[model samples]
Target: MTTISCTYTGDLHCEATHTGSGATLSTDAPLDNEGKGEAFSPTDLLATSLATCMLTIMGITARSRDWSIEGASASVDKLMSSDGPRRIETLRVTLQLPEALDDDQRALLQRVAEQCPVKRSIVPLINAEIHWA
Candidate 1:
């Protein structure tokens, strides 16, 4: 298992350290939530995690198959609920992959991306709309 340690730095801000790699990141509340909005908010990180996880898994699959996805990229837009109970309502993801791939390869990568750990864990809880280009 992996471990991450976090410290609340006051004023709706927090710092997290990845124990494995010593990597660190900071998070702040969004402007709408009474914060400076100078950095990625918690919900933003959630959306980012999904997109990055999908790309990472897809890259792994492509590498295993001797395929190149060197320029593959993904973008995500996070939408929050306006009704009761503040939470994420939707995460719209657009994936752009290299054009050199064939139909079968593209299909395979799409499947791999859909089955990514983050996507499998968060779907239905948060509506995820994925688009490929």
Candidate 2:
């Protein structure tokens, strides 16, 4: 298990440190949620994780097959519910892949991304839309 330490820096900001990696990050309250919108809020990180996880897994798959999927990136758009108990309603992801991917390769990569551990794990919790480009 990993332990994170966070200290409120006042004015709707918090400094978070990752003990394992000696990395530090800052979080700001989302604009819609209140407080001055600045850095990424914690929920933003969650949405980002899902998208990055899919990309990472797909990269690993390509590496294993000796395929170079360079110039590929994933874009994630998160929508939050406006009602009480505010929470993320959907995460729309679009992956831009290199031109090297053919029909079969595209299908395989799509399957891999959708079946990635993080994607499957969050299936019961969030609505994720994955698109290939």
Candidate 3:
């Protein structure tokens, strides 16, 4: 298992470090949430995690199968709830492939992406739409 440590840096900001890699990232409350939106907010990070996780999983599968996905890119749009509680409503993702993939390969990659840990961990209420580009 991996451990992540975080510290509240005040002013609705926080710094987090990944224990395994010593990698670090910062989070700031969005302007709509009462602080300056100078960086990715916590919810933003959550949305990012989903997309990144998908890509990472797909990459792993591609490598294992001797397929190439170099230069692939993705975009994620995080939509927030309009009523009830403040929360993510949807995570719309668009993935741009570096090269055309065969039907079987595309199907496998799509399955891998949707089965990513982060994607499965999220609430079902948070709708996810994966688009190809």
Q: Return the lDDT, model 1, position 71.
A: 90
Return the clash pairs for model 3, or none: none
**Predicted candidate 3 versus true structure: per-residue lDDT over 1-133, tens digit per residue:** 9999999999899999999999999999999889899999999999899889989999999999999998878899999999999999999999876666788998889888889998888858688888887
TM-score (all chains, Cα) for each model: 0.98, 0.89, 0.94
Which lDDT tens digits does candidate 2 get at residues 3-30? Answer: 9999999989999999999899999999
Better of 2 and 3 by TM-score: 3
lDDT of 1 at 27: 98
Better of 1 and 2 by TM-score: 1
Could you say which candidate leads in lDDT?
1
Better of 1 and 2 by lDDT: 1
Model 2 ranges with Cα > 4 A deviation? none
Model 3 misplaced stretches (Cα beyond 4 Å): none
lDDT of each: 0.96, 0.87, 0.90
Model 3 residue 1 lDDT score: 94
List of clashing residue pairs for candidate 1: none
